[model samples]
Target: MTKTLALIAAAVLALPLAATAQSSTDAKPAAKAAAKPAAKPAPKKKPQVTRRAAKAVEEVTPIDTSTDVTLNEADLAVAGRVHTGKIQCELGADVTVTADESKPGYFTVSTKGAKYRMHPVESRTGAIRLEDPRAGAMWLQLGNKSMLMNQKQGLRLADDCQAPAQVAMSAELKLNPPKSLFEGADAPTSGPVKK
Candidate 1:
């Protein structure tokens, strides 16, 4: 009888421990679920900034307009040659160069969505060069063609640009190509010799 009583006491003591272990195991998952709710989807991101946006910002940015850049006679002469009005380029691109009446030797060069304030910059190669230092843009005008380049980006914006004079010059060049210096002078005629 005593052996049976001790057995019953052992079972009673073990019952509580087993119940607590089961409860703890059940509570862990519930606590975890409550502590960490389902992660909400990440919020959508804003659109990426664009080059056009940056350019727009640049337009609004204040810059000093008082600094007068004086040009000499040569620069003025070059400016006069700079073809104003719409000039066409290859790939159907066009640029409009308008001289500033208020500011001689100054021009506003525009294309598509961009505009630059340019001034004649003397060129050692005899090409007409207009530059907008702030914008890092340069316009090079040759006798038969012209090109606009972004010095900062190291890329050509427009090429083969032709004004009326340039168009005429190009046609003339096609009709009468320049003589090559390498070829020898024409041989004297067999029967005729200069006295």
Candidate 2:
């Protein structure tokens, strides 16, 4: 009878411990579920900075820059025979524009155009050679710079003067007082070349 009672006591003690362990195990999963995060999707990323390789893909192809220009008769009547209306130094094929410290933000180049408005420099001496053909150059003191013109390759004032006389020369066909000033060339001849 004592052996059976001891056996019963052992079983009674083990039963509550086993039940407590089982209960804790079952409660742990619920607490763990609350502690842990739900399944999360991946985050989207922003665009990074563009590299040189990416810039290469974005870049346009290169192109040829040189062009040969021809002059028309109407282009001739312009002041000083220069392509630019403003009096600026135009660089020749051989010339280059360089930066200068004394005159910052401005450029210095040696070049010239085909024609010029000659402002004769008068002194005790007579007219010197304004058009220096040895250097194929002419000096034009134009806005904030001096123009050193090359006359060898293209047309110059000297070249234009040397044009065919019939096309180049200008003649004034003046009429006599007896004539009406408004009369046509076929009306009358009162002077030398016109007559």
Candidate 1 differs from the real structure by a C-alpha RMSD in angstroms, to one decimal, of 34.4
Question: Cα miss at 120, model 2 (Å)?
Answer: 99
Best by lDDT: 1
At residue 146, what lDDT does model 1 achieve?
Answer: 79
- After TM-score superposition, the amount by which residue 36's alpha carbon in candidate 2 deviates from its true location, in angstroms, is 12
Give a tens-digit lDDT track for model 2, residues 25-96.
898677778677755544644422222212122111111122232324432232222212233222322233
- Clash totals for all candidate models: 0, 0
lDDT of 1 by residue, 1-195 (tens): 335545544554465588689988898677778767666654655423222222222322233333467899999999999999999999999999999999899999998887999998766446677888787787878788877877666667898899999999889988987654235345545876445
The candidate maximizing TM-score is 1
* TM-score of model 1 (CA atoms): 0.59
Q: Which stretches of candidate 2 lie over 4 Å from their true place?
A: 32-195
Tell me how far the alpha carbon of residue 131 in candidate 1 is from the true structure, in angstroms, after superposition: 0.5
